[model samples]
Target: MQHYTVIKDHISSYPDPIILRKEQEVLYGKEDTQFPNWIFCTSMATQKEGWVPKQILTTPNKQGIAMATKDYSAHELTANQGDLLLGLEHLNDWTYCKTENDEYGWIPTFCLSASN
Candidate 1:
C-alpha cells in the first residue's frame, strides 16, 4: 500500500493591496472606518475613488503618456506633460482613451505611471 500526499494552496501570497498615500495620510472611504489599517482593494482601485494624482510619462510613441507595467514596455497613449487625466473612467481600458486635449484613442497597459 502506498500513502498519498496532498498539497493545499491559498492566495495569502497575493501581493499586498496598495493604497495611494495622500498628503502623508491614508484616505479612507466612508465605509473604511472599520478596517482602518487595511487597504481595501475595492476602494483603492475604482472609479468611485475619484482621480488620484499620479506622475505619468510619455510612452515610446513619444506622443502620449506611458501607463507602465512590471514587464515589457508600457502601454502608450496620447497625453502630454502637465495634462490632467480626468475621472476614474480614464483609468479603464488602455484602448479608446481621451486626453485633456479631447484626443480619443487606445494605448498599452504597460505604459507606466511615473508615480508607480
Candidate 2:
C-alpha cells in the first residue's frame, strides 16, 4: 500500500467515515469501484479503532499557489506560497478551492499552476 500526505483537510462523509489528518494510509478501492477520481483510504488512527475503513475521493485537479494570496476579510482563507489547493471551480481569473486546512476561498488564477 502507498501513503499520501494530506495536502488539504478532508472531512469524510457516510458511508465513508474518517477524520482530518496530516497523513493517511492508502487502500485499494473495491474490486467493483467505478469512480475514477477517488482513492480508497483510512487514517492510521481510524484503523486502530477496528471499525470498517472508508474511502477518500481523490481530487481530480490540484494546483500550487506561487505566493500567499489573501481574501478581503481576515476570516476568509488565504493561500500561502507552496500550499496545495484542491480545484473546485474556475471562473476567469480566480479559482475557488479548498485549502490544506479545509478552508474554502477564491484565489487568483495567476498564482496557481499545475502541481509538480
Candidate 3:
C-alpha cells in the first residue's frame, strides 16, 4: 500500500455517519450536489442517515427504498497538515485511510499527497 502525507487539514464534518450491512434496506434522501454519485440515505434498521455512494446502493424505487450492495461505513478521518496515513480504499473522490494514531476514516484526495 502507498503512503500519503496530508497536505491540508480535514475535519470530520459528519459526526454521525451511516453504517449498513450487506443487503440492508434503506430510504434514499437527497443527492449531494458537491459530490456526484453520492446520496444521503437512512438505514431501515437504525434510521440513522448519512451520505452514501450510489455505487454501494441499489437503485431506489418511487418510495425511495433500496438495498445496500455491500457493508459500508461512512467514517471520516480528521487529520492535520503533515500527518502520515496509509491508504486503504479509494472511492469516488475520497480515500479510506489509517492514520499514525491508528484511526481509520475517509479523506478527500485533494488533501493528500503521495509519499515515496
The candidate maximizing lDDT is: 3
**Candidates in order: C-alpha RMSD to true structure:** 20.2, 15.8, 1.0
lDDT of 3 by residue, 4-46 (tens): 9999999999888889999999998898888787889999999
Tens digit of per-residue lDDT, candidate 2, span 71-108:
12112235555677776765444455777677765555
- Whichever of 2 and 3 has more TM-score, that candidate is 3
lDDT of 1 by residue, 1-116 (tens): 11111112111122322323322222332223432322222222322222222222112234322232221112234444344342223333232234556643333223324221
Backbone clashes for every candidate come to: 17, 1, 0
Candidate 2 CA-lDDT value = 0.39
* Rank order (by lDDT, best first): 3, 2, 1
List candidate 2 segments past 4 Å from native: 1-76
- Backbone clash pairs in model 1 (N, Cα, C under 3 Å; residues 3+ apart or in different chains), count: 17
How many clashing pairs in candidate 3? 0
Best by TM-score: 3
Off by over 4 Å in 1: 1-76, 86-93, 112-116
